[model samples]
Structures are given as C-alpha cells and as structure tokens.
Target: MTLPTSYRAYKSNADGYQNLQLTQVDLREPKPLEAVVRVHAVSLQFRDLLVAKGDYGLPTGAGIVPCSDMAGTIVALGEDARRFFSVGERVCANFAPDFLAGEPTPENRAALGGERDGVLAEYVVVPAYSLVRVPEHLSFVEGATLPCAALTAWNALTGSTPIKGGDTVLVLGTGGVSIFALQFAAASGATVILTSSSDAKLALGRKLGAHYTINYKTTPEWDEEVKKITNGRGVDHVVEVGGLGTIERSVNAVRLAGSVHLIGTVSKGASGIPLIPAILRSIKLNGVVVGSVRQFEDMNRFIEARGLRPVVDRTFPFERAREAYKYQDAQGFVGKVVIEVVEE
Candidate 1:
C-alpha cells in the first residue's frame, strides 16, 4: 500500500478548544522501532479537555495534537519494526508508551495528549512495542476507548489484591472509567453498586451489570446507602474517580482493609480525605494512572474472552472533532465520546 505524503490533524492552540484547527502537515518516516498508523477513531477523555484548556497541571506544547486513546490500522512500518508488528494490523497505542510493565516511574510516565503529541490525527507514528493488537470482537471505535479509561478500570479491579467472586465494588459515576469498572467487577463475579446523579444513567448502569444503583443527587449520603446495600460491611473496592470531592465518602464506603483506587479528579469541592477514618479502617488507596502496555494487552484478552463491549455515548465526524470535545465536557454521556478519523 502506498502511504500518503501528508495528512490532516487537529492541533490545539493557546486559546483552547475553540481555537483548535485542522491542519495539513507532512508525514515523516518512522524510526526503526516505530510504525505509522492510519488513525480510524479517537476517543476523548476528561484529560483531553484539560489539555486543550491548558489546565492539565502540565505545559502543553504549542500545536500539539490532543487525544490519548485511538484505534488504527498500521499502514507503514519502519525497518526492523516487523519483528513486533506488521503493516495492516489493527492496533491501539498505549497512553504511556514507555511504561511497558510494572510500577510506573517518573521517567516512564510520559503520556500522549499531555506529555507529547497525541492521536487526534489522520496518521500517527508510534513505537511498535507500545502498540497492542485490538481484540477481534471490537470495532475501531470500541478499541479507541481502551488506552486510558478502560485500562484504568482494569488496573483498579485486577491490580493489587484483585477483586474476586463474592466481593463487592462501589463505583462513583457512569463515566468512562467508572462504567468500565462496573463491567469489569461484575464480570469478575463481584457485585457492583454504581452511583450517578441521573436516575436514567443509573437505570442504564443496571442493564450494564451494576447489581445496585444509587442516585447520589437524591441520596446525598450515598456512602450510607452503600453500607446498607452491603449489609453495613461496606464494599471490597471503591473505584474513586471523584477525587477530593468524593474520596471521604469512598473511604467510608469501603470495608475494613478494602481498596480505593484513586483514578480521577473530575469533581470539585474542598480538598482532603478523612484521614482519621481512612487510617482507622486500613483502607488501601491506590492511585491509578491508566496502565502499562502489558496490562493493556492483558485487558484486551479478558475483554475478548468475556465479549465485553465499550459503551460509546456518541460519535462525531472528524470535521466536528471540537464539537465532540464540547459534548464530552457537557458530562451528560454515560460512557465515551469518539471522533471518527478514517470512518471505518
């Protein structure tokens, strides 16, 4: 196949999402260990919004393409790249490309969309080693949702002291990570209690395998509701995506010595957890930053084996990528929002 000499990609400007532009640029040859992917679909995350607005707690390089998660077909491979991956393979690039496995170090924590140019493009060159094959049962759009949100959920459930049958899980919302957590925990034979302000989303969560749902808007003290649902023993794991705003309640919702996987800070309010209660209960607070490439591969295997499908709330054409960002920022969607680059 003949590779294109150039392609179009969206680049964020200093003015933020409103100023984002689709530009045509020359494509460069990949390094010996890299391959060029023709991006089929890209998915938005809360972090993508933060990066576009220059509020991600990191410096955004001028003209950086924004979006971490993408599914694409490898259209070209550099010399020696064939040992790991071949042209025409469907794959997704890991968010943190360098962190292949094990605990994350500062040196290995460089991520796409924030630390580097990301996948909101017609084509992208990435290290072959950092790419994972998409599951046979998933579409490019579904595969696009995995690199960040799905991997974080996978790490939360199957990480330190993995959840098992008879365990109970409490997920904070119906966002990408939380919904994936609910699905994963339920698939692992653990009961799930999902919280969302919208009763409609809660109903959808039930259909997605949440054993119980709480409308946090109606039940402000949803932690107590979790306790009541768990017979006052609390749950085995709390997928805490609410950060400072909900960590205290998450700590309260977990059983003694249970784990609280801290994944995001999308909510607002006073900062700080209930230190005394957390200490007394011996709750494990594990901070999740997606996962490694190895974990991504492992998660894909499980997803294929269980036939789990990602919940994509909406999809936009490549020309309407900015609108996709706005739609995700609205926070009404139950799962991921996608931008179709190649429109497979």
Candidate 2:
C-alpha cells in the first residue's frame, strides 16, 4: 500500500517555555525491519512538560516530537515486518527501544520523547520488534495511555517484589501511574490505600476500588494514618511518586521488609530521605522506569482479560496539542490526558 507523502506532527523547539508547533513533514517508507503506524491517539506525561520547558535533564534537540505514549494502526510494513505485525493491526510503540525484557542497563536506557523522537504525530516508524498489540477491549485513546504511565505502574507492582493477594498497597496520588497502580492492585485482590489533595478524587479512587483514602493536605502526618489503618504494621507496598520530599514518609509507612516503588518527583523541595527509619524498617526502594516490550505484552494480556479501562481525564484534538500540554501542566485531571490524532 502507498503511504502519504507528508504528515502532521507536533514539534517542540528549544525555547524554554511552551514552544510546541504543528508542522507538516515528509514521511519515509519503513526500512526492512520497520513498520509505519498511523497514530490514532497520543497521551501526555509530566515529563512532557519538562521536555517542553527544556528542563528534562536529557538533551532534547530542536524539532523533537514530545510525547512517549501513542496508539495506532499499522498502515505499511517493511519486508520482514510481517513476521511480527500485519498491515492493519492496532499497536502501541514501546517507550524504550533497547530495554525489551530484563533489568535495565545504561546501554538500553534511551527513552522516547527525550533521548529519541516521540509519537506526537500522525504517523510513526518503529522497529517491528518494538510494537505491542493493543488490548482487544481498549479504545485507541485508552491504549494510548498505556506505554508510559500504565507500564511504569505495572513494573512498580510486579517488577521487583510482586504484590500478592491480600497485600495492602499505598498509592501516593491520583495521577496516571498511581491510578493505574490502584486498579491493577485491586484487581489482584490486594487492598489499596491512596492519598490525594482532592477529596473528590479520593472518592473516585474509592469507586475505583481503593480501600482507604487520605488527604495529604489535611492530614500532614498521613504516614501515621497509614500505620493506624494497617494496625501499626504499615502497608505491603508504597507507590512513592513524591521523590525526596515524601520518601521519608513513605519509608515510615511500610511494613518491615515491604517495598517502595519510586516512580516520580511531583515534589520539588525536601529531596532527602531519612535513612535511619528506612534502615530500621528494611524498606526496599525500587526505581521504576517504563517496562519492556515483553512486559507491555503481558500488561496488555492482563488488561484484556480483566476488561480494565484506563481512566482518561480529557481528550484534545490533534490540532489542540498545545492546549493539552497546558492542561497537563495544571494537573487538574484524575487519570491520563490524551490527544486524539484521528478525529473520527
């Protein structure tokens, strides 16, 4: 089949603020081991804001596409692509190309949207080995939320110290990863505890099966509340998104030998962990990046079997991509923020 000569993509310039601009660019046919995907939807992460503001620690060069998560249908394939994907299957691109299965190494840590070009486009050409079929029950918008946020949450729960049934989980906030963790853990028969500034979001978390909810703003010593909820034993796992600011509290909120999955830095100040308490409790702090293509496939299978739908806060059209970035920055949503590339 013939491909379009050019397609539209949101490109980020090196200006320190919101410098996203839509541009038409030439589309090239895939190489022998590649597949060209017609991207149907894309989603935002907190890191996209960093990349847009030139603060993402990596060298985000000019003309870089800015989002790592996308879902699409295969429009064209290379000579050997048929071995893995067909011409019309729905799929999502892996966030990292080299980190396919095992423990991450420095050599394989190049992630999309920063070290590499991302998927905020009408089409993307990816290696055939890097695409995972979307869950059978998910819409393209829902599938678009999986690559980074959902996968990171999956790795946090099942990667290092896998949570078992009846284990109690403490999720930090109602952001993308935290919400996904809540859903996945609840489905696994674990009781979930979540914290958020919004009582309404906490109510929604309860609706999503979280057993207990805390308003961190009101209850500053929320860790003590966690201990009380668990009868002074603390929780089995803590999804720690607050980085240094909240790590101390997270360390205090876990049971002996429990795990803490470190995923984000939503907090800026207080970037130091209280080492003594962590040592006393024997809390395992695991750093989480998005997982591999194999893990993505496993996650898709679980999501399909359970009929789990990713919660999307809101969606913007492809032309309104800049507004989507600003919306993500305001952080007013519950789950993922999406951009619908195909407006059907």
Winning candidate number (TM-score): 1
Clashing pairs in 1: none
**TM accuracy, model 2:** 0.98
Measured by lDDT, the strongest candidate is 1
lDDT of 2 by residue, 68-127 (tens): 999999999999988888999999999997678898888988888888889999999888
Q: Which stretches of candidate 2 lie over 4 Å from their true place?
A: none
Residue range with the least summed lDDT across 10 consecutive positions in model 1:
10-19
**What are the TM-scores, per candidate, against the unseen true structure?**
0.98, 0.98
lDDT accuracy of residue 117 in candidate 1: 92
Q: Measured by TM-score, how close is model 1 to the native structure?
A: 0.98
Deviation of model 2 at 272, angstroms: 0.4
Question: How would you encode candidate 1's per-residue C-alpha lDDT over 42-102 as one tens digit per residue?
Answer: 9999999888888888787899988999999999898989898888899999999899999
